[model samples]
Target chain A: MKIHENCEILSLYIDGRLDPSLKKEVDVHLLSCAECREITDRMKAAGKMLSSLEPLTAPPCLEKDVMDSLESRRSFSFIRMAPAAALFMLLVILVSYSLILPGKRNEKLTSGQNLLENEGTPPAVSGDGLPGAGSLKAPEGTSAKATTEEEERLVSGRNLMARIDNDDIKAELKDRPADRVPAASSAPALKVEEMKRCETEQGVREPEERVGMDAAGKKERPDTGASSTREKMGDMKVENRESEERMLPYISSPSKSKAALPEAEPALAGTKESGSPSPLVISNRKDFTMLWNLQNASGGLTCKLPDIDFNRQMVIAIPSNAGKTGYYIVDTVEKEDGIVVQYREMPIRDPAPTPYQIRVVNRKPGVELQKVE
Target chain B: MEKKALFEGIVREEKDKVFNLAYRLCGDFHQAHDITQETFMRAYGSFERFEGRSQLFTYLYRIACNVWKNSLRKKSFSSFTSYRLDDREIDPPAREPSPYESMRSEDRCRMVQKCLDSLPARERAIIVLRDIEGRTYEEIASILGCRLGTVKSRLARARKSLSEKVLPFMEVAGK
Candidate 1:
């Protein structure tokens, strides 16, 4: 093969890698060709200059930052962990609350979902005002024992009265105002934790020690024998149920003239205090998210929003008309629609027939007639 | 680049070998250490995408070579154009002193380092690995993953160009 000028055979020739005859051929060429000799001389000079090129020395502790970035400084901790803790705590609260103080929030959610699901569009069940959820129905083909029917109605009635209570709980939950603090934000917390880990790791410790401690922190924090997150979750659920009860419809009426009818008494409020939602048009999810945005709505509040299963006009019995009168019911179902709840207001305080209901009612004067439940 | 088997095999057999190569190449212990770490991290990061067709060491060495080149690029020493601007016009802003300079040779080395910095990372890398470091064409070809002919041409060109730039200051030992 004819050797090209840039052929690596020149390199091979220098390393003595060519075959003996080839080396001899190269050697003879080197003697005759001054141009070839110049090339060889330049090659050697280039090699010497490169080897003689100075080496850069690293400053001490330079490896620390790299190690820091690698070890505990990435978001793997929070992404893999914090939510798991929060979720675990939330589950624990639900399980424990189930055991300690029995409440029907789940049942209410299930039934509402059931109404949304199996009921195939049942008539509108409105719990405007009453202690027990006076979810009036044609029984919707649910052949529950009379007791179960009674229970569901009562529970739903409570949920409606407690509807404001849900808002109140939301108000309470938001009370912490932790939202303004960057550390409380989901992604920020992870970032903060990673930064802290980086600082801790890079601060003068041996690499092995830093790694060991990080591994230990991961194990200890997320999964040590102490699974308290679950218990915290359980407690949160209990608080949620309590808040749910607070929002239930209960009082007989606002004025004291008529005594509360015996039948409308919700078990929780022996002596009742009450509230209501306005009949204003809510345009969309924004309004609902706002409703969820409440004072006292704390302890990891989450909601499975009603798909607002049915939309029909039913007068919800106002057991305790304890809110500002201008407050009309705002339809958050199917977006916010301002609907007038036309009810005959015979201002009275005593409860009568059906105890409480959500429908047009005829009333005797001085006796506050509520939409019968 | 026979990416998987290359990675698996190299990761298993020559992590230290390549790391040593990087350490020697950069001439700074910690940077070398870091270059090794980053090289492996990159190798591992893209390990899943490796499709095996080339030798493992060759594949990893290619990655290492690219990585070192990148480091050069990051320092804004990408071309002779930038080199002239920084050297002739911009005084190197005040720098924190390093602890290791001990000899005139080192100071001379630092001066030459300025010249090396003037070259793009690709050229300097070719010269260092091929000429000074004395890597064989197959090994350099294997490391760089180029055709042997391309390696030869790059080696010759890299040496000729580096020689022209670095020759003025040094005392050459007459052979």
Candidate 2:
């Protein structure tokens, strides 16, 4: 074996790990090689020096320290989990708060929906045609007890509208002179004239002739009519026909003041010509909010109602077609003569009633309806 | 309670051997105490898994080797330099100056420990286990989790490295 190889094995040789034959070979090499002999002697001396180190005694406090650490670790496990518990509790509170907010919104929406459903009943209008004592006539097939409950809900809704209107009038009266303020008796008359202009611009046929034509058409195409009114008002203008189908005839409430009754006649006559209808013009925030909530609850096509300054802007709501489904306002074009509302009717799988379509317009005189195929 | 008592007895019996091994490996008295405590704590934690395949001290020596290796890694370079510096300040002086033989022995022990500390942790452990602790080659292999051939080769290299560091010191001391 080479001197280098012998040097490498020198440590193992001192530790007695080498075979007797290899040890004999190294022993023979060591006898002759001075470099290998010196290296082996030094390595043996180093081993002896390491072996002579005194064994150290362990400190007395070791066991106590370790036991204390283990005990503390066991006791504080709950403290380690505190953050996760806090985060879980926060998540639960957020979920419940989200759930409860929608529930309250749904309650307000439910009451508004009840008011809309009872629209078939004629409103007992006061002589001035403002929100009067609400007396609603139940539709056919509804029980009297259900009618009374519906009447009470409608009365509460009307009372809210009356309070809003009174507040608006008081604010208006404060801003204007007594002479410039329009008479309460002439308000319905102006509304009638506006309806007439709308009908003329839209080319709606007279209500009686359209009703006759609808009756004949229902006989020929039995499936075309989905309601009694649809069977009775075929090919009529949708706005006028649906208005007649859904709205109650405006009749004077049993009030002692007969002076304003005569002024409301022109409005009643216009209703007969155009078809019986509710007030389509929403002029206050309270009315718009109620309508907006009702629209959201009905789960139909939703419109983006612009933020309207009520003094300058109004919303004209086209009566919903209760007999047919899948009709929604596509857009509104404001023209010099009048505002033209364009609507689209798509075929739907389920034959559910269409929802009301409203347009935010400048508080102008007239609005015409147009259907887009 | 029985397991605790049994482990305490084991700690009592093995502490001196474990401490001596640690002292030779780290070349620091306080570090040896800490390493011994950590080894017994680890051994007690894993006592249920001991299975008694080899002797209990062999298992504990393996754990001590691992603990020492981990401490070497966790210690920063600056902290290691500081430990070397602190070694001079903390090492106890020989009590009896009149006894020249005892003083010479203590000086030789410090020189040998300083040379052992200069080697790599793995080589230092090998030298400490084989030369200082007097473990057999097979038992060293079991403690280090290496082959018998690897143990023999490593011990040879470790002893050679230790000789290189200690021989210069020995020459100075002789002069």
Candidate 3:
């Protein structure tokens, strides 16, 4: 065999692993080849040096360490419990995220022109409030059935009010100071003062021209019947319609009376043509009585709630649509035309019926709302 | 015997073998202790799956080698540092001067280990299992899970590499 090929067998020969036939050839070659012989001697010496390495006795405490670790592992099975711990963390994150998301959504609604954009829409209901009821004036039929359905909705809304106290609403309003209408100027008794404001603004109608006008019998004021009135009223209608496109009709509490009301009038008067069948405008006066103008055929109404004493507050539950109601807190602000009593809407949890009740509760500042069980 | 008892018996029987292999592989007693502990822990976790196809000690030695490799990877040695062997001394510096005989034995051992550490991990393991542990070729083949022919070729290469490293020192000492 060649010297290089014999060199390969030299290691196996040192390890005593070479077959007998190969060993004999390698042994005979080793005698003749100095290079191969030197390789064999070197491999053996290296193996002997490696063998001479002292075997280190494992530290005596090693057994204890290993055994204790195993014992403790029985108590805390990280491998077995890791998945459960991960699942628990995931649940906590989900619940916290869900709770935080709605508050953020509400805060977003009140930011910038969002407050102006959502004016006159149902306050707490999300995008496109009062679905299918767009731009349509309130029913001229205060039929017994409509009134009854309205009452049923009011009851449901009241139940919802009991569940969702004013705390969340207060938190939402904390940032919206400009949207509040100052109560000292515009606060008035509901039925009488709202009638006076209406009469003073329109000048065409007498306060004696009561509600309950049917579509056919509706009287068109002679001057308002002119095309100019129709054209101006149509423009106001279009503006109010556009503003309500993003409406969340949120109302602030009486406690927020010092805050300025957002400049978000739905142009109820401008949209009111004397002869049109508009939504029944219920102007809530200071004394808690309602004034309904059956002739105002606009999508929104304005109400002046009472100037609540610091110790007393009012909760006005109004059925907004089929599935939701708006809880309005009476915060009044005065304008050049008259006292514009504005209701800041509290977010309703569910939809309810109309004729939402006016409940005046004596509550001290920082006291919790009494839960109506 | 109950499985727990059987497992404990196996651990008692094989702990030294696994520890020795780990010590030779990493050349640090404390690190070898850690490696040995981890190997047995892994073996215990998978003890039920062990079918005894190979000797229990060989199976455990394989685990020790794997743990040692994983430890090296976690340290993230730069490729250059990994390739440049002899960075780790087999023994820590002596607290005091030792007798000449013991120091000589330690120097020889360190030289042998330095040469072993220079080889790639696979070849180093082959050298350790075959030469240092004195396992037969058949035993190493089963332990490494390679063919007998492969084991022989690898062993030959590893020995040849070690000789190149250590023979120079031996020749210098002889002179």
Give the Å shift of residue A30 in candidate 3.
2.2
DockQ of each: 0.14, 0.39, 0.40
Candidate 1 similarity to native, TM-score: 0.39
Q: Estimate TM-scores for all models.
A: 0.39, 0.51, 0.47
In the range A133-231, model 1's lDDT, one tens digit per residue, is 133222122221224433333322211111121222222222211111111100010012222233234341224312322222222121112124223
lDDT of 1 by residue, B60-135 (tens): 6778787876776685323223222123343221233454533444455555556565665555666667655566
Higher-ranked by DockQ: 1 or 3 = 3
Docking class of 1: incorrect
Over 4 Å off, model 1 = A1-12, A15-26, A48-68, A73-373, B1-37, B40-61, B72-108, B111-115, B169-175
Candidate order by decreasing lDDT: 2, 3, 1
- Please report how far candidate 2 places residue B93 from its true position, in Å: 11
Put down candidate 2 lDDT per residue, A35-119, tens digits, no spaces.
8888899999888877766555555665665555445654566678888899999999999977875555444433433443434
Residue A136 C-alpha lDDT in model 2: 17
Question: Could you say which candidate leads in TM-score?
Answer: 2
TM-score order, best first, reads 2, 3, 1
